[model samples]
Target: MNTMTKRLTAVALATTLAVSLAGCSHWSKRDRNTAIGAGVGAVGGHVLTNGSGVGTLGGAAVGGIIGHQVSK
Candidate 1:
């Protein structure tokens, strides 16, 4: 059981890292807002929900808005 749990945890970590890195590489400055939003959302989500999903949504919204304003 312990071994299985460890394997699953490792897979989840790898997936998260891959996704973040892949996202950074694919988007350019033109889409900076989107990237920022996502990052903020992630942090917010954690903070807002005590590491729950709600914080993520809030962070995303705030980040996106900030990014947009910066671009303008």
Candidate 2:
């Protein structure tokens, strides 16, 4: 995909994740943190890797793990 498309996709994904998480009133703080971390990581990965899919997924995974552990 072109650079613009990739950037837009990343932004959309992040926004969707954030908005969806915001509506989950029953989630604990850790749950929220994980979602937030995944979103941020995805964006960061996309930027760092120039929109590589593998990079994005890896970032999300690492971020989720960190977020999950942060509350401990």
Candidate 3:
């Protein structure tokens, strides 16, 4: 990837982090757990796939489901 792509990825990740942090204070424990799971899944996916879009999305979806189920 080029420098521009890397910069854009960084910006997107930063934006996601900022938004997630901003809304957490008002969320229930369940909601916070799900979000945390998704974030971890995204990072895990990125690492596992060398930052492939499919892997990231798959990880987020799977992580979200697992997190939601665990909250029950």
lDDT scores in order: 0.60, 0.86, 0.74
lDDT of 1 by residue, 1-72 (tens): 355654564456446745775757656664766665566555645554654456556766777677767766
Candidate with top TM-score is: 2
Residue by residue across 37-56, what tens digits does model 3's lDDT show?
77767766765676789988
Best by lDDT: 2
Clashing pairs in 2: none
Query: Candidate 3: misplaced stretches above 4 Å?
Result: 1-19
Residue lDDT tens for model 2, 18-53:
789879879899998888888888888887788889
Q: Is candidate 1 or candidate 2 better by TM-score?
A: 2
Candidate 2 residue 52 C-alpha distance from true site, Å: 0.8
Per-residue error (Å), model 2, residue 47? 1.5
Each candidate's number of clashing pairs is 5, 0, 0
Q: What is the Å distance of residue 48 in model 1 from its true position?
A: 3.9
